[model samples]
Target: MIRARQLKDWLPITKKEIEMRGWNEVDVIIVSGDAYVDHPSYGTAVIGRIIESEGFKVAIIPQPNWKDDLRDFKKFGRPKYFFGVTAGCMDSMVNHYTANKRLRSNDSYTPGGEAGFRPDYATVVYTKILKELYPDVPVLIGGIEASLRRVTHYDYWQDKLLPTILEDAPADLLVYGMGEQPLRDILKAVKSGVPLSEIREVRQVAYMAPHVPESPDWNTVELASHEDCLNDKLKYAANFKIVEVESNKWQANRIIQKVGQRTLVINPPYKIMTEEEMDASFDLPYTRMPHPKYSKRGPIPSYEMIKFSINMHRGCFGGCSFCTISAHQGKFIASRSEQSILKEVDELVAHPEFKGYISDLGGPSANMYRMKGKDESICNRCQAPSCIHPVICSNLDTSHKPLTEIYRKVDAHPGVKKAFVGSGIRYDLLVDDFNKNNQDGNHDEYMEQLVTRHVSGRLKVAPEHTSDATLRVMRKPSFKYFHKFKEKYDKIQEKHSLKQPLIPYFISSHPGCEEADMAHLAAETKDMGFRLEQVQDFTPTPMTVAEVIYYTGVHPYTLQPVKTAKSPEEKQVQNRYFFWYKPEVRNWIRNRLTKLGEKDLANKLVGNTYSHSGNTPKQHKKNKSKRR
Candidate 1:
């Protein structure tokens, strides 16, 4: 690891830093909505470092003052190639507001966790400023905000469908997904004297043109135009299904959409990165900390949270409907080699702030490391969005031995006391009932290893919802599988005499979920002795099945109507079910359930009966039955 001991080590964030590097002009000046953190986890740092690795002078203007006289956009002057803009690691709207559409007071990506560091639509704001200042200079947009919004989709915060970000941002080019492969290709082409607008054939890129460009190499799929989607919501829903399937394919078709008179062409993404390539990306010269400029302001909450953690992989195959992992990272699991992961572990242990503990050795889904199709040819032709949903794909190799081996190797590090899997696990993969492919008992071995060694106090898993109908819409397994997994988990804990609790995450007000379902979830979980602490109200974001349903009132896959709680009152009623244990909400729950004619469930959840031991009603009943 190349530690940053001086300002010169980091990529130039100011004009003086550029002068310090003896550069009159940079090849690329990246404008980001996040504070400068030279960590591998941060997208701005990754993109900046990648540009530097390619022997280009790159500087980042992070969290530039949009309200000011636009000094930050002009700090490094116009780049030789183009300006790369991103709304940081998160989509700006999601970062700025809660699910309830309330303005958030803390920005985790900002120094001191203060709000108002960046505008609402940060990428659009930054790109517009750059374009206004230098109309001749080309602008490139990427990162989560751009990648997910590359096509016309729903914007929950705005409560309306917005066209491709290109329509508003007016960037010359957009690099979607992880951006490394596309960025490299674009840079090399620019170095070869090709203009950004002329470099059209690169994979994982989107651009606007008067008409669709013909490519013999890739078959093209024209989506419903933005105007058509606006006129017909079902057409919009159908468009989403196409976008989702194409996004997950190993060999995908180039996507074309009509935004207006101009056509938006989105070339297919690059294939899954090889182990060596994945290693190279993670093995970049990152300082693994925020820039020194923020030393007095206060620590960035997001950076601090992942400072000591090691990401083992890049993608998830679970493909939960509500998640954006597959949408941005793709469904294929591109995992680092063991050497790369262990090297990161070594760096983490050596960091000054590390306390002999590694915060996480995980990715989008912790247990999905190094998993893929058993048949390469099968994966190439498959278009299914999820690998282990509905039923675990017969072609999938669900072995846990590789991950277990890596965990053991990580534990063997002399300086490391514990390396926890902080990322949420796909718990269904562990249940033998759900995953029958674990013939060698590797799941048991891995579970024992994780519970015995990795967990700090609790391990988090997302069952998502309890109702089967809701789980189906969410692309999750039934709650019965959760019960089976919990039983096995309890057995393992009992056998080891360990007390670590299993924290299951759930969502309220999701599409297909009703107040009654939430009540049942409350009663069932209360019976399981859990007052759920990790619950969330479903917030529809762009390019997800749930979000599409929320806007269109129909399942994108089935094109059938599905009820979603949209009103604040409906959402609040669904949410209150999760807090039935609170004395203040018990009466409210009783009244609501009584109105729903679910008096039995209401009594099960917030009954008048109480015990001195403070056990739940069901548990108290069990104790009474034992006495009898």
Candidate 2:
């Protein structure tokens, strides 16, 4: 049977079980979900790769068809340890994430429905199947998806931060933070015959049944801590979210989750990769072949049509409130040499289907390449996760020389018509690239080319929100600066005769956003004629700044977020900001506007609403606000 036959994609060991525990030919199987849509890259792929590198036998089950019977995995036999690593989903959970946000939920299935065949369920399903196949194997679960789901997180669809996935999904142990070093330690400990009970004390790992309690035995806070009694406890509870773990500047290791609460609070383990380790990890002999695993499947657009992924660096320096890149990838931006990028582009140009378009090249922020703290040793001593910025750390490097050269070389390549940057460009950094006046001539020139020539239709940017008050809460772009950027882009488009438009990406229903806040945004949109087609509602993925806002109604770090109505009705109002006409919203907007004493603006809003024609959801949300 196909199930019984040897597996091709994942690095599975023998398909037959070994006789005894020690005699078991294998010690563990690291189960990882591929962030590499095409496989052989990203998330678990890297974790598994690193494991195999350590001389341990690790079989990476790339992307399993979650709908299939969990029993099929029994064919691969069992390992002394089973490690579950996911990029973002287990069973159908990954597929459920809406790529195209337009589709609304029908009655058949709900977006926040926790009990179905999700990753956690699939973890259990597979665990049980493994048990039936080989009784004593241990399954360890961890990854961002599981890490966040470790405890209750804010569920946008349900309008609350819910509880840990562990209670529901039967995982034996959980690796809470970045699992690299932690998993390595786990494999070593397990293969050496460490008992499960004894393994509980390891930092960064939260097991289901602990051999010993972390706190004093008498410190038990009841099975259903104050959380279970809340009217919406199941909806807004946190399982394992870690805030700042220590007073130390070892940022990654310091910012952590509260133990066993089902939150994703811990950061990746290391603060810096030794020069040699960084060189070895990135400078591997990577050939530009279709990732070996996916090549076996026929070519597809996401794989073949794209050129080099061109990772210029590894970490991020920005702590944009809405993003996890810096927290997850860490803030240390390790860049590749200029020669490396030039070679990759040459290869891209040589590809048979090479159009003049060189595709995209980016990493973290794409700008902070080979940057270090001003005083590396001292900066390491200062434990704040992000540099307070503008004050200057001794270790941080704000210079863009290395990055600029790479950009120049790629653009100069023979077959390259344009080199796009899919990675985000930190505009705030750009604002500072010049001589303290928010204008840098050379920075402007290169950035203009990158945005206008490269971004195919529009340069996408996330300003998150436009209110000065909200920006502070979000720890990001100032409304004043973003407005200036809109003006700058307009002038640039006119000056360069570029066809690209500014694709400003916005989010609706973030923790601090209110109906009035959205209304204010709509008014700004009307004034700017900014017809935004893309709107993202917040998804409080476990262990994020956003989740903390939903839970305590306070920033877990700072204890402040403007109270906004988080109800569905309030969200619907915000969703309509881009639209100009909808009768229900129109009426509500007019009434609300009149009460706010903006009679003249209300009339103008009505006029604008009437001028727009369509009655789609977007349209209604708009007109309703204008009229109100």
Candidate 3:
């Protein structure tokens, strides 16, 4: 443990000073400047836990009701060690999703559009506060927000992932990749009298300034001289191929360098931590919650929300072209035992506000549980996250038994009125079951049991798009199949005398999606009647093929070119499904429907006046004219 008086001033302290604090002593205090909490965006929480596991006392401070004053952060007690800081999840929302994704939460809350989007997020104010206070606190910034926007990229708001975040957060060390392993290595090295500058050579830690003086031509990059810097602005900033140094470090790139003194992007080819490591990390005491501060809130984790999330499994075998779950989670599954889930459930139920309902129970695909590789050895390393919305990889066990049984046990509890499966279940997996096609099919029998007996009324399913071409791109089940399942579900509900619906979600502007594709989806929804929640203008997330396509307009997998949706008018048209009923929107929809031969939809919209419009451009213009 490194002990010091100030930020970046943790010089070689006496062994007595280090020993003065027991193994449980906190040499540093970590401040997590996060915007919100959810599973997957748990970068800060994991870091805090790992540091604690290493015998360092760590406190995580929540900035939800956060004041923009740095003085507010002084409550966690002064650190005799170091402070870690981040730009929070909104930075990720800006970097990974379209800038509009940040607008999503605000949109969700605000009924008239503003109500339901990112709220309480004052990045500018928060960052300015950080800048003013603790100017010398050796701050560290990381997470998707910082990683993706560490340098300039295509930021939608500013129209690019400009150097804005770095400029604002002002981190001393910009740790990227999976930060846990890198952080420990960094802290240890610094404790060993290594300067932060010397620690820059470590893999996964992206530091400022170039390591090498010049760029090595890719073809000429030698293995021993593996560290080459890039000079080109875009490529330089993106030199993150520092793979884990495995038995075979040369697994992916033979040479990872280009022009410009960019930096040696470490894509460590090392095999990720084994299954035991993964299990140990995830299987930690579920009872442990990183106390944001040693204090009490009025009430915690509302019935509608959960404080921390426990991942049910690792890896998604489903290889959807546009998804990165496979890239991040891997292409295999390592599910936790039913017993573990029960333990988590017990903890949740024990929460003083236990209302017998968990906000959600899920993994990559809520349905995939206990999937493993053929060999136990490979399974440990095969922590791949399967894509749930589209294709279910052949390797993945699409068995619903384990999950259904687990759900039944969870739902059967007297206190729990509802157990929602928030993660989208794979629709294709359902088709494989007998119930997908036959109302009297065995699969249908299971469906009846699950839906009537186990499932909450609104079971969420992601049929990303309706058009076959679009489905093909999403690698998802087609419109024909989704409808078949819905029909079966409807019949099963009728038979069971239950009221439940397979509420399907759709995404617009996924890589291959187009105006015509969206038109097809609109038609499908019209026929289905007041059904289908749509995700408009899919923004590419980090390491996702879909995002690559969204950026390059070229299919990452097939190298094929696709027609992209860029026009504001096009986005607004498709968005009408989410915000349907704008008269101008209605006119646009009617015109679109008329063009697509969806005459009934066109007629219905223009005739009945669905009346969901808020303030349309036409309305705004008209109001302006009246004022004039």
Count clashing residue pairs per candidate: 0, 52, 54
lDDT of 3 by residue, 317-379 (tens): 565655545544445455666776676666666666455666567777766666544344544
lDDT of candidate 2 over 187-281, digit per residue (tens):
67766878543575455555444322444211222223325414533322232223322312353342223224443222234445444454444
| Best-to-worst ranking by lDDT | 1, 2, 3
Candidate 1 lDDT tens digits, 1-628 = 3354888878889888988888888999999999999988999999999999998989999988899678888888889999999999999999999889999999999989999999998989988899899999999999999999999989988789999999999899999899888888999999999999898999999999998889999999999999999999999999999999998898899999998899999999899889998888889988887888899999899988999888888888877888899999999999899999988888887787788888888988999999989999999998998998889999999999999999999898899888898999989999998998998999999999999999979999999889999999999999999999989989989998999999999999999999899999998998889989999999998889999999999998889999999999999989988988777788777777789899898788888535445456788889999999
Error of 3 at 38 (Å): 12
Q: Please, what is the whole-model Cα lDDT of each candidate in the order they appear?
A: 0.91, 0.53, 0.51
Who wins the TM-score comparison? 1
Clashes of 1: 0
Task: Return the TM-score for each candidate structure.
Answer: 0.96, 0.74, 0.70
- State which candidate, 1 or 3, has the greater TM-score: 1
Instruction: For model 1, state the Cα shift of residue 42 in Å.
Output: 0.7
Model 2: lDDT of residue 322: 59
